[model samples]
Target: MPLSSTQPPTSTMELASPMQVLPSELLIEIFVFCTYNDAFFPLTLGSVCKLWRETVEFSPRIWQRISMADEGSIIRSRFLARTWASKSKPLPFDVDINAECADMILPLLAPLLPSISRWRHFTLTGEREEERTLLVSEEPATPCTDLVINFADYDSDDDETEGRATFTRQYPTSDRYTMTVWVHEIPASTILMPLDFTNLTIFECVFTGQHTHPLAVIDFLSVCPQLEAFYFWGWTHEDASLTTAPPTVHLPNLKTMTLKSTCMTRSLLTSIHAPSLTQLYLAHLNVDFQLPPYYSEDGDSEDEANDPSQSPSSDHATGMGLRTFLSRSRPALRVLEMDFSDMRTKDFRFVFSRLDVLEEFLIVASDMSDKVINLLKPYESCDSPVRVRLPNLKKLALYNCQRLSGDAIVEAVSARAEYTDANASSKLQTVSQVEVVDCEGFTSRHGQTLAKTLGNRLRLH
Candidate 1:
């Protein structure tokens, strides 16, 4: 009879490989490393053989991530659901589901609903209100710490879209009640959610409609006192209505803010008190630098203040609003970015002078005239006590600054590096990195000089 093919070779020349004889624990560890690149990856290795399948099936970490969507049929979804149920429970569950794939996911996920407290992150997007309601219904007791909601409302009658989003989380009475909402709109709509906001830290709202009541945004923020970051983006025509000055909402922990609007930014900035703010980004395309009357002592009417025919050079009003905001908040701001094509030289100086602790400053597609460069350059007064602007500045980036000259750029960098106090201590720290992108006047010669001062820290393109 022929020797059994499955049997290990008896001779010393041939023997069973060490891999085949590896312990179950070691094999499972090797499997985990093999599947680390993708989520729900062990499922691929589990199909090789009976022993390997059992090994993968028993590993909980290998099945911690459940990333599934419809595969064109209910039969496939049902099989996938069964597979998830049979595998180990992935703590801090992460899930992403949309309206189209909800039907297949809901039933499969029904069995895991009792353990909703394990969920840490989730994203839900839907096309209809009913779909959103159903999705929330299955997630009544989620302990999710981070969430994202995107909804699209499309009607057959018209080409435009109107959407409504609603998210409700039912926690199992825990102390950690903080949850963040990241909101955006592609098709226009309103977002509605019911949750405790005392512990919330971040709010990112993007408006796409002609108007979203400023009160609506304020109402949501008013309840979240612990909010740390906020972002708003909309177009010029989508003007927000603030009939009167809104109540000042204090966000003690807020550290970052990005606002993109025409006339609404004035009211929004004035109505918030963020003492911890360190980063501020502003983008406005409107010609008139009209701020809310609440900020102006003269109390000008909105129409007069918002006149578009006014020259963009009249940016003092806008600059004053920002300066007042900084003075009130008194935040140790480290980063300041702006997209101001016509920002006044004096206004820029006033703003820069206040940020004594600024570390990173970026000017994008803005005026970089000799006057602006002089304001940024560090200098000691000959008649009075010594002083420096942006003493802590380390990273200076100027993008598309057409008016900046190579000599001026070199002078600015060298001044910071050479600044010293009467006691010989460095008063103003030198910039370790300077990035000049598309600044036509800053030629290779300018870069060569900067490289000598900043060495490899100079990045020019």
Candidate 2:
């Protein structure tokens, strides 16, 4: 974009100013700072001054981020995309494009097609199948490190609606390039194979409805051998009618995984082996809290849910699958967080015992019982000879654990805080901080008692 001759010329006094004497490198850095907080830097910094505009043009890093919001015109978006693509040469750029303008803007991104190989990260938000197809169709032979796709018109503020989930692919108005075709299931084929999932290290897929199948996910995972982080939100579940299990897909490099859907948890946890996994977060929006049957410390149990022969759809299947996964992976887990889940006490014991190095544990809105306290109870005082379950645990938080008694909470914290060896040395399992929030059976007196015992180490809310 060249400066127009009609534009005002610099004043003679301003030309002699100290600001005009700054080096080109310093000026380019200043332009970067002007737009460092924004993803659309090229659009704003190109019009500053003749020298500054040239500096921005010469610096590829300054023009490497491209973001298109919903409020831009098609012509403007196309112009900005072309300008940035031309200036950010030989460097991989992070691209974020909202799907709302796909009809008008996507086709005009032809100038950027040849440079797609330099894309480091691609985020497509609220895209329909056709727009996604268009993106892949134009993509060059490049291997992106991160990819995020939202298959739904997702409103993060909206609560989960009732009924079977569904994906609704929307397009522009009929006068525009509208797509009339609709399918009951997501075109999973477009996701992995088209964009080449083999190179992706971090991937996230979110959908509106229960359209994705477990087999589709398995297929996706099979291709992503280098994936280190995988996150899925919304209806990624297996059809209960599908009794046959898919072959287990191994992700040897995967380290962080978050599954926020119940069905997805049940589907993926049982199917994937991630030997390098260390961080896991699981949440289920619709889990019924049924107390698990009692089992001796040795884990002998007769409950149907506890039986390994039970079907995958059983109330405890997800938890059981998680336990099996942790056992198989044997990851040096340092952080574990579970929320809004139905995992029972026995499942907790099974999972916790395997994580010998877990240093941070956060459990919220789960069907926790007194057994949870018993597990967290300092190992030195236990009747059994097993080492402390979480000897390395430094932080513990329990929120909305209604079944756990206040007395049990007190005892758990006291054990963690006061536990010491015969030589009066502090045990490694000593919890430095404890936070309890929104749980029943705790009063101000209980808070005062804990505060007095643990001092400021305890937080009661």
Candidate 3:
């Protein structure tokens, strides 16, 4: 019956099955790559779909790192609790409390005290007195592993002379893995507070005043057995009224140190020792304090000759403390940076020898004095077949050096190459590259001249 009526089959297209979906592991990886804002990532991802929300809820690692804006304390607490309830893995959390909103914000975080054990990275800035007091008392629900408290704003108020004292007395002691404190523009009384935490690895104290005592800081560091880095920035006054001297404290585990002072003397530099230090930074130092081996019978005569304006008791010296510190720790140091352009040329020569193992040397000299240039010049010529042994050097940076000419700088670097080759016994290795950055007085032509002089040895950035 259909022979005459047989028609071509309808042109219907076949439908393909849904594309194979990615494994949950792959999705989680994608989430991890996208994971950033502690507060926003979880909330935003939760809103995408039921499946994604479930995946995020179950991924504790994703929720472990939380950074809530001071404005979103309420949301942070609620989200945090829910994440915990979902059986997500426990991870480190970073909570940044806003300094301006600290008063209003402290109350919100108080309720989360029970869950504090979940915190691994706790950052508190501009914290209110009551809030800090409360946090110091709350038993960690989860042991905090890393804590960073910045009290730079303690001196932000005109009437807050007691801010440092309050912070020192009330600073929270955590059983965390590492702790760092940065205190600026505070008085000595604040600096005198004892740091009792034994587990701390990194500690920094920066004070700006005419009377900052380095001794107080040194004493505080001596108590910590696990300390790995210590930094001090002290500003002293010309008047001798401030009697507190920097303490001579030694931390055997310390690997990095930075010290800057407007009035530090040579003796202060020689007293401190940290045998394991790998990086050192010094700035705004005085070089005249490095006293000569001999002086006239009349001490007053020598004092007057050095500087009539400076009192006999005034401590001044170039690289005195640095030289002392390096003499003990230079063997381990890999990075060395000095901003001593404000210092005299005599200090550079005194300090250069200490940086024999330094792989990265950054110098911001006040001027390229002839002494400094000569000291920096390679002891040999470019034609010499011997290679310089800056054995570990990968990068060398010179900044804000106005007195050195491009040609002079190149010659000095070439000499370094020569010195390395000449001294077969020396491990001094030739630097793979030299970088000159942010030198206002240096022109592009100067850079070109350096490139030409050093040949392939120089890299200008």
Candidate 4:
């Protein structure tokens, strides 16, 4: 990292450069920005001039971030790691190495990986299982504020792929290194149980296949009691032989939750009591619309395939679980979005009966019908917001609601739009926007009626 003899000696260095005249603090920042103490900075910046050379020699904070990506030779990378760590002493290290051979690089980093001070950011992204061992086998002395691990070869374009699990601390203190690792297989352990889940404000986990059990996920949510936003995408159904009730956990701080196609969808909703939840998005929760007209919403049929909402597997909590979670949490939900759901009308009724404070409701590819739309028909002459069915409901959007008719939706919107307060003041629950998309029965006449009533607030597609 020394200046080569090719450059003139320090005493005869160029004198009129702006960089040479700038304050040492600004110059050091520029150095840190040029390279986060990578292999190139020392040789490049140190050889820039005598002032730059002295600055690099003296700044430890500038060497704080030691990161490398895709090095051809692991041996050369290891040498750089040791040198960077040695230079970044007395400062917390943020070492990120994204390479095919990252599993081997960790051992070379040694005690730095485990130092409580080095708990700044340790991360991996979708590699082999050997890299997953880094998640906990050499656990840090203290749990880091931020840790990201992807246990699948996740592709954003593919919905079937296993997704990433991210655990990030809302307030990260750079007192130590942070570890973020992405491994291809879920670690064989109890998913790093020893780490402190309380530090996480946002926790996301994906169970795309049968490799992860429901209990592990349940146990995981139980520890993150302070989570503000939780996302779960489980695709596997329980084995028929493994029927058991999953324990529920109360997430008092959780405000937003998104659940996607999964058998444990109901179990998770049934198990978690998120009283503070305000935004709820459920997608493909129940995927069957082939039931007979006489079939009961209770799913009393002996054949399981007839009712996709009915879990023939060990997941005893049926589609009713969605209703249960909503009614129980009783959070003043502001946004409720359900996509590709085949949930019964009664489930919709349950939600409508409970969430009077809902401001926006978007249902896509749902089994919503005329009866469901009729549920939003609040009295036209109500002088108070409290008397309305959905007093806070202002935005209504229906997408691919095959069973819904334009007349029912238009009637609902017209009835709900009448503020009609005795004080001549608009009620807070009045309909402000209505969007109807891909509903075959939603004709142009319905669009005109709603357009006259809602003006630009009406969106017909």
Against the true structure, what is every candidate's RMSD?
16.8, 15.8, 18.8, 14.1
Candidate with the larger lDDT of 2 and 4: 2
What is the lDDT of every predicted structure here? 0.57, 0.59, 0.50, 0.58
- Ranked candidates, highest TM-score first: 4, 2, 1, 3
- Please give the distance, in angstroms, between residue 77's alpha carbon in candidate 1 and its true position after superposition: 36
Candidate closer to the true structure by TM-score (higher is better), 1 or 3: 1
Best by TM-score: 4
Candidate 4 ranges with C-alpha deviation above 4 Å:
1-149, 153-210, 236-244, 289-319, 379-386, 419-428
**What TM-score does each of the candidates earn?**
0.56, 0.56, 0.50, 0.57
Candidate 3 segments exceeding 4 Å error: 1-128, 132-211, 239-247, 265-268, 284-318, 328-331, 340-343, 380-392, 418-426, 438-446, 453-457
Candidate 3 structure, TM-score to reference: 0.50
- Per-residue C-alpha lDDT of model 3 across residues 204-225, encoded as one tens digit per residue: 3234232334344344455444
What's model 4's overall lDDT? 0.58
Query: Model 1 Cα displacement at 261 (Å)?
Result: 4.7
TM-score of 2: 0.56
